[model samples]
Target: MTLWLCQLVTSLQSCLQNKIYDGKTLTCTQTFENPMCLTFSHHCFLPSWLFVKFDVSFIVHLWHVFLNVHIKQALNFSDTYVVHVNVFVSLQVIKVYNEDNTSRAVEVPTDITARDICQLFVLKNHCIDDHSWTLFEHLTHLSIERIIEDHESVMEVLSGWAMDTDSRLYFRKNYAKYEFFNKPLDFFPDHMVSISSETNGMMNHSQLIQTFLNSSTCPEIHGHLHAKEQGRKSWKKFYFVLRRSGLYFSNKGTSKEPRHLQFIAEFSDGDVYTLLSARKMHGAPTDYGFCVKSTKRGSPRDLKLLCADDEQTRTCWVTAMRLFKYGMQLYQNFIQPHQKQKTPMRSISENSLVAMDFSGHKSRVIENPSEALSVAVEEGLSWRVASHSLFLYVSFRLVPNEHHHGCPVCFAALHMAQPWFHSKLSRDEAHRLITQQGLIDGVFLLRDSQSNPNTFVLSLCHTQRIKHFQILPVDEEGELFYSLDDGHTRFADLIQLVEFYQLNRGVLPCKLKHHCARITL
Candidate 1:
């Protein structure tokens, strides 16, 4: 039967190629090999006499109909037959720029999310998935940019963009995207947060985010912000309240009354963006300027420009707006990476290892957490001392003239090799690099102090603001050391200082977690 169908198909193909058909009964006497026709033996059956009066086009149509019907039937018998389907997926071309302005064009599915794009780049660039990588939408004309939420559709965002605009997508680290989940207090100061009138104005610091997520309760973020008046260049200070419904400003002095509360904007129709040069571009009073950009309008005139007194204030407002808009979805984005981690970060053998004390000739595992921590610290200090002694010995052997100079010169050169250390970088440049990388707590870099050539500065980000700590050179016992606290706590080199701060917060606001890095792709 299969051989006969193969011959029939061959005859039809010959007729189609010649553009000729006769109104005569067809017979399958000519032998031909067709691998495809044999698979339809059990799935389909056709009477040979049906093709007696048919033309070439009718035969082709009938063949397709039978093939489709047989294919549908074969799908039910999964063990015996397999069907292949060709599905066309819509694709979009998007260009993502790095910190150095180098761009890479990527072809992704139209429905790809921002998180998926970040993950793609992470794999391509061979970067660690620290959850700090973020996608930013930069509008060149307005000089404003905003972090695209992880779940936001990239195609949807592009749909809102005008073709003539010079808007771009940036792939970079933005640690602050989910920093609020870790440091809720820093993101939401107690003074800025308040409960609705139904309950006492007091709010639990631990449950502050819970209040925002709970639709039943109304959590308000109230503060005084400088707002740029509509169609005017001048700005005025107004008491603003941000709730789940929308943002409102009090016409009267800090009044929460319904009559005095005038609506400013809502997050449902707008997105919050940070101004690149607030003072220069928008004549903003301060550099900490953020605006509510309407999704429907791309012009700067449609923006609801607002400036906070400080970075913390601006972060509080922006973070609150995100929570109000996305609610639990933002939280899910924060924890989704962790949920995908199938294996434990630490192996079972590593987890079983504990700190052991051997000072008493007999060794015993330290049960107390504090005792274990102290033992670990002591071991770390001893190892550093041994390593330092070895470094001095090696220097003495390698370069005889440097024996008297000690390890200061060698230590200074050590930081030059570190990725976080950008020598001779100005304070402003350091701030820019850290800001471009991530304006989250503990994102830091080291640079030479412009004012004092002998010292270095540690530029760190905390509460969405950049801060510089001067590391002055301290001389003690003919050995040069670096210290942030005048000669109290000293380190042999800037590397040691940075490593110490990474483990211990000490005088800094937060422990260093991420270093600002630039990669050429």
Candidate 2:
């Protein structure tokens, strides 16, 4: 190969020295003595005119071709061998907005799923992977939004949007995305469920989801819903029935006869979306509004608008529709995170930690199970007491005058720094924030009481509805403290109160699992 390349270089140099040039162009058809020239005739040509047009770059390119041929022949390679590889990658740039309307541009593959994108952002933002992160498709023109399922291909979802439409993808936490899997009874109320009247309307709670997943069995959800008239502002209440085929309404008052049923919409060609402003924008009778939006249409006039009496009823209908549409795929998405979690290996730090009893002069490991449990309980209590004492001391130092009308100054200094505390926020605003974040069981935020200036309120979501509990300022032994259970449970400040409720349910419906966060990214 080296000798052949050297001979080729010598031939090129000779061709360059003996080149004939006309006024119009330079031309040289130099022939070589090498026998391999006949084998690679196309690449072995000595064209001096190429140097005039493309310069040395063209000559270098031909030299590489000759070298490749030489190597191929020496190694007994096939004639159809390729020297260079061309790779084509399918990548797309997408912008995902947050609840605050701030967006971050992400470069993803065309086949990327919504769950994969959520995992990417979760890793990029250094967030905990609690499996509640969700992606939303928001249509600004229609004032409608829907939760993009975890298994859905994001590129496919983007392909359905009109080029001129004001549509966006949002990344946020939606704890209720899979809450139906945990609490099926709450989602499918007894009155709303109609399982074909078989077995005399007696179905086990455990078997409720099985009915939806089984193709042989048909589970129908029947209820009364207020539907908006097309191209009109008035809404009329009707008895609606949801099935695997499509949504239907009874034209003759709750009758399930085929003659009385009128088809409304189908799930295969559209999706369910929660309306942004039910009353103000769409003239909904109540705020608990949802709609079936056709994938082909981007206008509000095409929407099959629906309104429910309350949040739970709306949630039930929406969850049932999702189940009817996706079937077992939704269940698989709910358990996918759990399936990915491998059995945790014992860590070195955990192995080093031992339950020890230090009450005696010499500390020893508690080998007995009962002894270890007792020790753990005692240590927990001691730690709680120590922390409480430290908090009280700090509060006293911050506010020396304990009798100064509710300790507003000290309370402001401590709780204002916490992310969960939203001081002076109104009741409506608190409800909006909690609803915007998620309507999961434990999502909550702390805000000042709207009616009383001195007191604060804990706005929390239990079962798809936001409930408030006032944190009254209690005067115990001439010292100021905050309590949710009248005066039974007292804390030095609001920070301690929130932390306690996070661990212990206390008077709240559920433990505070997540706080309503308004992050910039």
Candidate 3:
């Protein structure tokens, strides 16, 4: 206490002398020239003079009174002193880049990650609730960059940077990030989810998950689960194994035999969900418990609430159930996320795309294919310079055949139809198709709108997600040009714009590649 009090007032006299803080009083020696003699005022006596005359007890009593009145007023908030203290905070400014290259400053938390921050902006902007947004990490100093995986924290990525200030994170659409939820065929192979016709009719469900895991597969899924009693109130635990066929519990001890193992539930027409706050809400053993609820419009009592030992076990069981139920859709939802991030701005080189004019009427790639072959076959790829409507083309490499009957459209690339290089496509079907692919960046195609046939829409990928940008028709002095960036960028025709974006990087990561084409021999 003695030491603390001494240190407390160590700078009191000096601060009071210079008036650093308000409301404090000080007495100083009289100011004068060097030759002038000093004089003591009668009103303010020296400390020695006052102390020498008073008894020790009287001095202590006076000191107590002085501290009581003055200290309370000076220190207490209810008194005249309203102290405003400044706190120091170490903040790092992170610039968030939008689809249009516009940016906003995000006050990122120390524990923030790419996915968390993206969701923050999504909520703030009132964007769509699709879980396809992604964060792109760019190291300007090192001339290299990569996607910040959903599991990777932003701080962790920053820590690996060579230059702190120069490094940047790009947030944009990445449908592939969650495309598997829509495209199931690209993920689950035939043998993985199929019941073999040659094998015994009696299937061992344990071997189902093992086969999926062992294959050089489209998706990785496996985990442990607990099977509970059918009674909703009377709960009991039984260790179980989840497979594509259904949920099974080991009667003896982790038994794989059909006799020892018993079937519990199959998710063919159902879904599974993890129960939140199970300890309080459902009286579960652990809060990390889940249930496989049938979707057959049954009573809530029919649902089986199974509890896992921990979060990992619960998560594994739930994810595997979803895979078994939805199969390849989930895998397709998160496909080609790393390599297929296709923001319009991060696209191919700008000079590579070529624009053309479509005139005021409907455009066609080739009016007649047989006549074109005998006349000018290359005319089908014409760069129309019509004074009214416009056309464009992005560079595309035509592979003779892409994995058998599958076209690039099956994987979110360009769509081609003779006499109509680009046409209209339903948004749902487009989403279902793009997500089926790996969600490659710069994967784009042009199509007319169902509501407005006069104008067109450009569907493309950025950050592995598909975004539809409107292509508005503009008539400037008898000249027609289609624009997607609100006239910030324009093209003579839809084909020209498509061609331009393919070879050039115009708001897209790479040039156009895969296109649907038909040939007659």
Candidate 4:
């Protein structure tokens, strides 16, 4: 089947020679090996098709549509070449991060919406399409990134990217992403959604707009504060309230009447940052300090300085001020979590039970091609005892029964005891978990391989892809050596191997990033 398609493509390329345009002829000079074709029932007006080279699917979908139905009538074998070749559109290839962090550079039609690309992969990979997959446009250099909404175009998104090179489009899981839009309460915590005395000290979702609509009842964040006075050398503590009007402190207590209030400052058009030299600058409270400055582009000034009693208080005040300043976008970013489009593809369940095969590998499909399926089946039951002596066994230390403490092989695992590391997950589950927070390059985990029982597989997520490295053991001089690079670079044990890979990225895609941490206190 592949060969027949190859021959057909070659013939089509040879015949598609010249094009006549604007009375002057321009040769169809470029030889397209892997061309994409889109056809219209009537005729297309596309000048040409040009994009990154991708195999089979391009020709199957594009050529099949154009050649039989549309292009045959337009073909010209001789000069005067009166042709009306009407269909061809090629798409660019972008790397998509699969569930296990593995990357597949897939080509997609340039003109279609981002949702189309997700649907293509869902069908191609035979995944149960549940429609949660997404294409993330990351303009890393420009410091701008966002999930390409279902309605947006892939080419349009790429065109907006401003970078010399290093821009990327990520394909991964984002379940809670847009969930915030429908369920905003899940995204905004209680502290951030507080109601002040401005709304009679109580407000709900329905009342939120009504409360803020009237300037007189606008939400305000007020609390006790230690502030710097202009004329006074000594600092004094006062009851401070942040309202739409401005930051004000009561001359006496938490009194709202005009007589007892004094205006401190207003930060309608400025920004805030942590004051590193807080103690030296304005005698700010030690360690619990942050500063706000006016963003008057050219001119720089050491304006108003405020201090909080603790870091938490400082964070609350600064956050409230920011909510006050950039209300809409910031609030949207908070409530409307960046969600990816949903698919119909089957999602990997976290509770799916897995059992080991006879050879003691994670019992995945017979993946080690070197072992013949018939032979593996023949020796499947007794194969464990057969390779027992030669195979220096290494399994995941994250398993509950495995005592990681004081074991040299599990030094990294014991220290990096994250929840994701505690279980063996399939590629999709891994991708979903890693993307739950962010696709940090070095996020990684350890899982038992169903194909190889003598070794554990390291799943490292990097460059928006998951790379697998099999830990193999070699017995030399009565000592076991573990290696990922086909025994080229061997470590005394798994500990040394993990440590070496963390700092020096040898064969692995990227160095081991921080382990997934989950702490509840």
Instruction: Tell me, by lDDT, which candidate is best.
Output: 2
Worst 10 residues of 4 by lDDT: 43-52
Candidate 4 lDDT over 106-180, as tens digits, reads 665556666667666665665554445676764333222345556556776566444455667666655433443
Which should have the higher lDDT, number 1 or number 4?
A: 1
- The parts of candidate 3 lying over 4 Å away from their true place are 1-226, 336-521
lDDT of 2: 0.78
User: After best superposition, candidate 2 residue 496: deviation in angstroms?
Assistant: 3.1
Better of 1 and 3 by TM-score: 1
lDDT, candidate 1, 98-196, per-residue tens: 887999887666667888888778866777888888899999989999999999988889899988889999888887788787778888888888887
What's the residue-level lDDT of 13 in candidate 2? 57
Positional deviation of residue 161's Cα in model 1 after best superposition, in angstroms = 1.4
Candidate RMSDs in Å, in order, are 13.6, 13.5, 25.3, 15.8
Q: In candidate 3, how many Å is residue 62 off?
A: 92
- lDDT (CA) for every model shown? 0.77, 0.78, 0.50, 0.53
Clashes of each: 0, 0, 68, 29
Q: Please give the range of 10 consecutive residues that has the lowest summed lDDT in model 3.
A: 37-46
Which candidate tops TM-score? 2
